[model samples]
Structures are given as C-alpha cells and as structure tokens.
Target: MKLYIKYMVSLRCKLLVRQELEKLGLHHISIELGMVEIKEEITEEQKQGLKSNLAASGLELLDDKKSILVDKIKSVIIEMIHYAEEIPKGNYSDYISEKLGYNYIYLSNLFSEVKGITIQHFIIKHKIEKAKELILYDELNLTEISYRLHYSSVAHLSNQFKKITGHSPSFYKKLGKKRKDTLENL
Candidate 1:
C-alpha cells in the first residue's frame, strides 16, 4: 500500500514516518519525500493510528486523490530546487509536466486552485530561497550563485532576488544566517 503525506518535506520527517511505521509493525518498501510504500496492506485501524500519530508530529496522511496529486507536485518542485545537483536546462513547465505525467495546463490550474499561488510564483520563491542559502554560505559570488541556480544572468538574478526578497543579494549576505527559512516552511 502506498501512502501520501503532506508536509513530509525533510529527512527528519522521513525518519519520523519510518519510526511510526515500525511502531505499527508495518513493513515499508520505500519512503521518499511525501510518500511511502508498505510491503503489506494496511488495515483501517492501523491507518487511523498512523494518521493520528503523524498529525501530532505536524504531518498529514493524505487520502483525497486531488490532494495526493497536489502533494506530488510539491514533492517534485521541492526535490528539484533543494536536492538536485543542477536545475534542468529546459523549460520548467516541460520538466514538471514530464515528471508528473500531467498536462502543464491542468497541473498549473490544479496547483493554483489548491495552493492559492501560481506555480511560477512557487518556483520563484523556492529559487530565491536557494539563492539566500548560497549567499549565506559565502562560498559563491553572486554571478556564480546565479549560474548555479540557472538564472539567465546576474542582472536577471538580482532583479528577481530583490523583487521576491525586498533586498539585494548583497544586503542578504550582510545580514547573514539570521534570515534563512527552512525548506519545509518554503
């Protein structure tokens, strides 16, 4: 049985889920961001127990089909921005559509309806968040950060960074580690 979880966006959440599964004697085949596959079918009582336990830990066990799709979209975007070695070089719309096996139009509409934010806005937010992390690390110059995040140019990156964050990247770097957001919150 496969289960979709909302707000399971970090390694910590994965560990918590695994622990809960073990407590219930559920053998899991795999646990990825926002999802888990168990080796055996789960009973209703087990599902309820797991759901309650997860809820107490600030995660949700998803059941609705639409909610599951939305969570999958979030998982893909999170993985792409935070975990991938490099952002793909093509249109993000094509990449997301291909990854999720849905038409871009449908996915965009569904994401907007469920998330109350356009998919583009979400992507920009995450990209800017990543830019902040790179800036704080102090290892990469603005130009390098721009290139690493696949921005068209430093000017383009600066423009979007200021637009989303209300400050230039340099200012953010000056402020340092005090302002970074966790990946789950983004």
Candidate 2:
C-alpha cells in the first residue's frame, strides 16, 4: 500500500514517519519525501492511529487525490530546490512537468489553484531562501550564490532578493553575521 504524507519535507520528518510506522507495526518498504510504500495493507485502526500520531507532529496523512497531487508537486519543488546538489539546467516548467509526468500547463494551473501562488513564484521564493542560506553560511559570495541558484547574474539575484526580503544580499549577510556574533557573545 502506498501512503502520501503532507508536510513531510525534511529528513527529520522522514525519521518521525518511520518511527510512527514502526510503532504501528507496519513495515514500510520505502519512504520518500512525500510518499511511502508499505509491505502490507493497514487496518482502519492502524491507519487512524498513524494519522493521529502524525497530525500531532504537524504532518498529515493525505487521501484526497487533488491534495495528494499538490503535495507531490510541492515535494518535487522542495527536493529540487533544497536537497539537490545543483539545480537542473533548462526551463523549470519542463523539468517539473517531466518529473511529475504531467503537462506543465496542468501542473501550473493546479498549483496556482491549490497554493494561491504560481509555481514560478514558488520556485523563486525557494531559490531566494536558498540564497539566504548560502549567504549566512559565509562560504559563497554573491556571484557564486547567484550562479548556484541559477540566477542570470548577481544583479538579477540582487533584484529578486531585495524584492522578496526587502534587503540587499550584502546587507542581509552583514545582518546575519552580526546576529550570529551577538549570539556567540551571549
């Protein structure tokens, strides 16, 4: 049996889900970002127990087809942006469509309807967040960060960073460093 989980985005979340499944005596054959395949079918009682346990931890066991598809879309985006070593080359729409085996237009429309934001906007938001993380790490300069996030140039990255965060990348880096320094002093 395959189960879809919502909000299971992080490694920590995977661990929690695994623990939950074990507690229910269910054997999971595989657990990916948003989907899990179990060795055997679960009884209603077991399903309820797992569902409530997951809910308490801020995750959800999804059943609705539309919701599942949306969660799958989100999982793909999160994996591509936050987990992948490098962003894929070429158009993001094509990448997403290819990954999900759906038409880009259909995915875009569904994503917008469910998420109240276009997939492009979502990707940009995640890319900027990744940029912030890289900046705070103090390893990559703006040019490197821009290239890592697939931005056309530092200028383009700077524009989007400022637009989304209301601060330039340099200023944000300085601010993050200062905050870290202050925390260390305390």
Candidate 3:
C-alpha cells in the first residue's frame, strides 16, 4: 500500500519516516517526499501505530484524495525550492502541471482553494526565503543571488525582497541571522 504523508518535505523527515517504519518492522518499498510504499498490506492496528509514530515526529498520514494531492503539490514546490541546485527552466505553472499531470488551471484553482494563496504567491514566498538563505550564507552577492534565483535583474530582486521582508537584502544580511520561517511554515 502507498501512504501519503503530510509535512514530509525534508531529508530529515524522510530519515525519520524510515526509522519509524523500521521500528514497526515494516518493509517499505520506497519513501519519497510525501509518500511511502510498502510491500505488505498494513493492518488497521499497524496503520494506527504508524500514524501515531509519524504524528509524534510532526508528520501525518493523509487519507483523503484531495488532501493527498495538496501534499503532493507542496512536496514538489519544496523540492524545487530547497533542494534543487537551480530553479528549473520554464514557468513554474507549467512545471507543476507537467509534474502532477494536472492542467495549469486546475492546479492553480486547487492550490488557491486549499492553500489560501495563489501558486504564484507561494513560489515568490519560497524564492524570497531562498534569497534570505543566500544572503545569510554570504557566499553570493545580491547580483549573483538574483541571477541564481532566476530574477530578471538585481533591482527586481531587491524590490521584491524589500516588499516581502520590509528591508533590503543588504540590511537583512547585516541584521545577522534573524529567525527564518521553516519550509513547512512557508
């Protein structure tokens, strides 16, 4: 059976899930972002145990189809933003659509209804968060950061950064590691 997981967006979460499965003596075929497939069918008691285990680790097993789809969407976006070395070419809408096998309009509508934000807004929020990370790392100048994030220009990046963060990237860097929101929060 394939289990859909909520908030399984990071490598640490994957490890935790794997550990939980092993603790339960379940043989998992694979565990990817937001999902786990196991070779054997799980009993109700085992499912409940697994769910509680995951809950203790700040994850949830999704049952509803709509909720599962939403989790999948979040997984894809998180992977693209936090893990990918570079943002993939082409528009995110197209990428998401192709990745999920849903039409762009349907994905946008579902995401907006479920997330209470447009998909574009979600992408922008993640991009700004990534920009902050790069700023804190101090390895890349603002210009390079802009280019790395696929912003058209440094000014555009600065404007968006200021708009979202109420401070320029330079000022934020100087402030020295102000708390950043977790990826799950974003």
Candidate 4:
C-alpha cells in the first residue's frame, strides 16, 4: 500500500519513515518526498502506531485524496527545486501540468487556494532558495548559476534574490550564514 505523508519534504524525514517501517516489520518499495510505498497493507493497529509515531515528529499520514494530491504537488515542486540540477525547459506550468497529470490552471488554482500562495510565488521562492545554495557552495559563479537555473541573466537572478532576501547575493555569500526553506514552503 502507498502512504502519503505530509511534511516528508526532507531527507531526514525519509530516514525516519524508513526506520519506522522497519520497526513495524513492513517492507517498503520506495520512499520519496512526501510518499512511501510498502509491499503489504497495514492493519488498523499498525496504522494507529505509524500515525502516532509520525505525528510525534510533526508529520501526518494523509488519508484524504485531496490532501494527498496537495502533498504530491508539494513533493514535485520540492524535487524540481531542490534536486533537479537545471531548470526544466519550456514553461513551468506546462512542465508541472505534465508531471502531475493535472491541468495547469486547475492545479495552480487549487494550490493557491490550499496553500495561500500563488504557484508562481512558490516557484520563485524555490528558485531563490536554490540560488542561495549555489552561491554558498561556490562551485559556480553567479553567471553560471543563473544560466544553470535558466535565469535570463545574472542581473535578473541577483535582482530576484535581493528582492526576496533583502540582501545581495554577494553579501549573502560573504556572510556564509545558512539559508533555509521552511518545511511548509518547500
């Protein structure tokens, strides 16, 4: 059976889920952002146990379909932003639509209604977060990071970064403080 988990947006969460499954004697197929697949269906007591364990760690075992869909959207956006090496080609809406098998307009509207933020804004936030990571790593210069992330130009990237962060990318890089995304935001 597949399990949809809220707040399973981080690697640590995945590890926790994996450990829980092992403790429960469950066989897992795969564990990805906001999702888990196990070979066997869980019993009621097992469900309760898992739910309690997950809840204690600020995660939820989602049962409702709509909630699952919302978490799926969150997971995909997180994957695209945090794991994808380069920005996808074509329009983001089209890419997300194709990825989720939902119409872009409907998904965008639902996301905004449920999350209280526009999909565009979410994408921008993720982009900025990714930019921060790139800058901190110092593996690539601003121009290269911009190009890799499909930003129009270094100036545009810096402008967006500064707009969101209230500090220039160079300043942030020099400060070397951690830039992190909230779990809900990711």
Question: Would you list the C-alpha lDDT of every candidate in the order shown?
Answer: 0.94, 0.95, 0.90, 0.89
lDDT of 1 by residue, 36-114 (tens): 9999999999999999999999999999999999999999999999989999989999999999999999999999999
Looking at model 1, report the run of 10 residues with the lowest lDDT sum.
177-186
Model 3, range 44-115, lDDT digits (tens) per residue?
A: 988999999999989999998888998888888888988898898798988988899999898888889988
TM-score against native, each model: 0.93, 0.98, 0.91, 0.90
Q: Deviation in angstroms for 87 in model 1?
A: 0.9
lDDT of 2: 0.95
Q: Candidate 1: lDDT over CA atoms?
A: 0.94
| Candidate 1 vs candidate 3, lDDT winner | 1
Best by lDDT: 2
Off by over 4 Å in 4: 177-186
Error of 2 at 18 (Å): 0.3
Evaluated at residue 45, the lDDT of candidate 3 is 88
Which candidate would rank higher by TM-score, 2 or 4? 2
| Candidate 4: 10-residue stretch with minimal lDDT | 177-186
TM-score of 2: 0.98
Clashing pairs in 4: none
Distance from true position, residue 126, model 3, in Å? 0.8
Per-residue error (Å), model 3, residue 65: 0.8
For model 2, how does the per-residue alpha-carbon lDDT over 1-186 read when each residue is reduced to its tens digit?
999999999999999999999999999999999999999999999999999999999999998998899899999999999999899988999998999999999999998999899999999999999999999999989999999989999999999999999999999999999999999999
lDDT of 4 by residue, 1-186 (tens): 899999998999999999898988999999999999999999999999999999999999999887888888888888988887666878999988999999989998888888899888888898899888888888999999898888899999999999999999999987774343333356
Question: Which is superior by lDDT, 2 or 3?
Answer: 2
